[model samples]
Target: MLFAVEVAIALFVRDRFVRPYLGDVLAVVLVYCGLRAVLPLRVLPAAVLAFAIGALIEFGQAVNLLDLIGLRGNPVIAVVLGGSFEWLDFVAYAAGALLALAAERFIHR
Candidate 1:
């Protein structure tokens, strides 16, 4: 599934473009989908929740919570929690959520 591919690229892909940006973009989509799977949120709410969660994670990175919790040394935790903060990643998450919302609207219309 798309989530699996995104996870693989996010973790394994070392290319500058795909690894840095695309992974962030797809992360919101994955988060949105996961939220929808458990919560009965509409597209907009799901996307919003995804963006909020992504922002929170970015904030966590800003504070070095991963390092505080000893997750920084683990590759999987490093990839999932992110090692450093980037403003661009917030933009990517918003863009990805917007795209997902638009697609959902188009499909459900």
Candidate 2:
């Protein structure tokens, strides 16, 4: 359910002002994973799951899978995934993940 919301936000809000902030997506994923850690899950497993979800999103963009649901082509996702190789997206993802980690720490404290 959370994952579905993430994907829905990605598809619908990608073109909004936050479109360039891929970090926001990563941060959201991290927060979700962090909160889920309240269960018996380990951190590495949670991070891997988040990464896998991100990878799946990138692949979906690459294959235009979202188009089936009326999402227009977004060259940004391709670039973020290294098709065109924009370093900024990487930084954004890192920042987002770090922010999430920090937030998790604060919350857990």
Candidate 3:
């Protein structure tokens, strides 16, 4: 279900708001859910891992890893790895992690 939402957002949403912030947020949520699907982890750990991975990806953008790896010409890889770095992406990732944690708690209760 969540994976579907992530795919929908990836394919459909392209406006400024969705592209810049919501994409980053949903990216983290997808990561969180993906990790949960694979491992038996507490909510906090899953969220932390998601956020950490997101941060690392953003850091990779700062260093232009995609260009170094010659994936800059690939649109799919460009979207997945991101071509540029932004501080707001970190905030969006954190927000997504918190939302994932809250949603998990709400659903469990």
RMSD of each: 1.2, 6.7, 1.3
lDDT digits (tens) for residues 1-109 of candidate 3: 7667766777887888887798889889999999998999988999999999999999999999998998899988887888899988999999999999999999999
Q: Against the true structure, candidate 2 has what lDDT?
A: 0.53
Off by over 4 Å in 1: none
- Residue pairs in clash, model 2: none
Report, for every candidate in turn, its global Cα lDDT versus the true structure. 0.88, 0.53, 0.90
lDDT of 1: 0.88
Per model, state how many residue pairs clash: 0, 0, 0
Model 3 Cα RMSD, Å? Answer: 1.3
**How many residue pairs clash in model 1?**
0
Index of the highest-TM-score prediction: 1
* TM-score between model 2 and native: 0.47
Off by over 4 Å in 3: none
Output the number of the lDDT-best candidate.
3
- TM-score-wise, the better of 1 and 3 is 1
Question: What is the per-residue lDDT of model 1 for residues 1-109, given as tens digits with 9 covering 90 to 100?
Answer: 9778887897578997787778888888889989999998987889999999999999999999997897788988888888899989999999889878987889888
Cα-based lDDT at residue 92, candidate 3: 98
